[model samples]
Target: MEAGEDIRWLPRHTVPDDLVFPFGGKDWWLIDDRLLAMGHTEAGRVTGHEIIDAPKGSHEAVALRNALWPLAIPHGEYRP
Candidate 1:
């Protein structure tokens, strides 16, 4: 999405959920109970993707990556 674009989204949960603050950068929070989504138009095409959970805080981004560097999410591994 770009500036001036209107993003429409909804939370995954009906009731308010926990507030997850970003470990770095900003202090935004993510709702634990609600699934999130946003819609936007790009190059004349409308597309959107679901918001997902990031592993807690990314405070140890480098360390986490180094520790699990060998592991990978195989294609279709988590698909229904």
Candidate 2:
């Protein structure tokens, strides 16, 4: 993760109200908004990783990225 640049964590309760819990069955990494790496976890361990191409300029992707900013709490600044 890049300091103050490449990583962000949004508190659980601060997630968008319209979004559902367990966002997905796996963890995801959006790289440069062009590739998405999905990590499959089992028993608290990462079991596998798969990468998929993504369209960064798409309306949906742009919208999601925009919406996430307001909900994010800088790392080490969250209290819960």
Candidate 3:
């Protein structure tokens, strides 16, 4: 965080527990407004990933991430 001027690092621990994730609870990355990269994990271990074309901008993922952004702690402020 010391040098993260242009990037916002929102760590997961500070987010509230009320976020309802889409994509079957799989971890996801909204890679711009065109692609969504989803990771398939089992027992906290990675299995594989799926890259889906999202022409409509991955509305669900975008919403969830936006919702999480404000709720999460900035990387510089997180103690753990």
- TM-scores for all candidates: the values are 0.20, 0.63, 0.64
Q: Quote the positional error of residue 16 for candidate 3 in Å.
A: 3.3
Residue lDDT tens for model 1, 1-80:
25553222322242134533223222122333232232344675666543545443333333433343344333334232
TM-score winner, 1 or 2: 2
Residue 49, candidate 1: Cα error in Å is 13
lDDT of 3 by residue, 1-80 (tens): 36544224555555557755577777777766458988998899999998988655488767776776766556556665
**Candidate number with the higher TM-score (1 or 3):** 3
Instruction: Identify the superior model by lDDT, candidate 2 or candidate 3.
Output: 3
Backbone Cα, N, C clashes tallied per candidate: 3, 0, 0
In candidate 2, what are the lDDT values of residues 1-80, reduced to their tens digit?
Answer: 35446456766566767774332635666666676676888899989998867464233444665678777776667665
* Model 2, position 70: C-alpha lDDT score: 74
* Ten residues in sequence with the least summed lDDT for candidate 1: 20-29
| Residue 2 Cα positional deviation in candidate 2, in Å, after optimal superposition | 5.2
* Candidate 3: 10-residue stretch with minimal lDDT: 1-10
Q: In model 3, which residue pairs have backbone atoms overlapping below 3 Å?
A: none
